[model samples]
Target: MASRVTALLLLGVVCFGFAAAEIVVDCCLRTTDKRLPLQILDSYIIQDAGKGCDISATAFITKVGKKLCVSHHSKLAWVKNYINILDKKKGGHQ
Candidate 1:
C-alpha cells in the first residue's frame, strides 16, 4: 500500500515536470494570429502561473460569454485601447 502511494506521488511529479517543460506560446486558444469579429466583454493579461507576465497576449471574454485569447502586440493602437475600454466598462467604473 505504501509503495503504491509512493509510485503515484512520483508519477504526479513527473507529469507536472513534463507540463512545465512544454512551451505555452498561447494558452486556451488554438489560433491567435488573425483577428476575429468578437465583441469584447472583458480583458486582462494572462500570468504564467507566477512564472512571469505575458503582456503580448490578453484573454478576452466575449459579450455572449465565450472566452478568447487576443494579441496585444498590434500595429494599431486602437485595438489595445478598445479592449481596455471594454474592461473598464465591465468593471462599472469607466
Candidate 2:
C-alpha cells in the first residue's frame, strides 16, 4: 500500500510539472492551451537581456508520438505583438 501511494504521488508530480510547462500567459491572455497546434515547454535560458520575461519567437513542434525541440532568440510576446500588428494592418508581411 505504501509503495502504491508513493508511485501515485510521483506520477502526480510529473503530470503537474508537465501541465505548468505546457502553458504560458500574458497580463490578460492565455497564449497556449491544450487544443492548439503547439505545446510549449518552459524556457528559462536567456543571456541577461534585462527583465520582463524574455522568450523565443520560435516554438518546439512536438508532433503526436514524436519528440522535437526548437531553439531561437526572440520573445514570444514580440511574436504575438508582431502578428497582431500585421493582422490589424490588413494582412501584410512585416
Candidate 3:
C-alpha cells in the first residue's frame, strides 16, 4: 500500500508538470484582408513578431467578440486610422 501511494504521488507530479508546461501562447499565424466596418470594432491588441510570434499583427476585437488579425505593416489607410482611433479611446497618444 505504501508503494502504491508513492507511485500515485509520482504520477501526479508528472501530470502536473505536463499541465504547467502547456502554456497557451496566442499568436496570429495569418492576417485577414477583410475591411471590416470601424463601427463593428471594439478594441485591439498589437502583436509583435519578436514576442513568440512569427508575424507582427493587429488583433482587432469586434463588437460581438470576434478577433480579426491584420498585418501591422498593411498599407490600408482605414486600418491605420482605426488603430489610431482605438489608441485614442484607450487614452494612448499615437
Predicted structure with the largest TM-score when compared to the true one: 3
Compare the candidates by lDDT and give the number of the best one: 3
Instruction: Quote each prediction's TM-score.
Output: 0.41, 0.30, 0.63
Q: Please list the C-alpha lDDT of all candidates, in the order they appear.
A: 0.56, 0.38, 0.78
What is the alpha-carbon lDDT of model 1 when measured against the actual structure?
A: 0.56
- On the 0 to 100 scale, the lDDT of residue 31 in model 1 is 25
Winner on TM-score (2 vs 3): 3
Per-residue lDDT of candidate 3, residues 1-94 (tens digit): 9999999999999999988773438788999877778888888877777776888888888879788888673656777888888777773221
The list of candidate 2 runs beyond 4 A from truth reads: 22-94
- Per-residue lDDT of 1-94 in model 1, one digit per residue for the tens? 9999999999999999988884654454332645656454544444334344434455666666666665543543555676557657665111
Which ranges in model 1 have alpha carbons more than 4 Å from their true place?
1-40, 45-55, 73-76, 92-94
Clashes of each: 0, 1, 0
Ranking by lDDT: 3, 1, 2
Ordered from best to worst TM-score, the candidate numbers read 3, 1, 2
The CA root-mean-square deviation of candidate 2, after full C-alpha superposition on the true structure, stands at 13.4
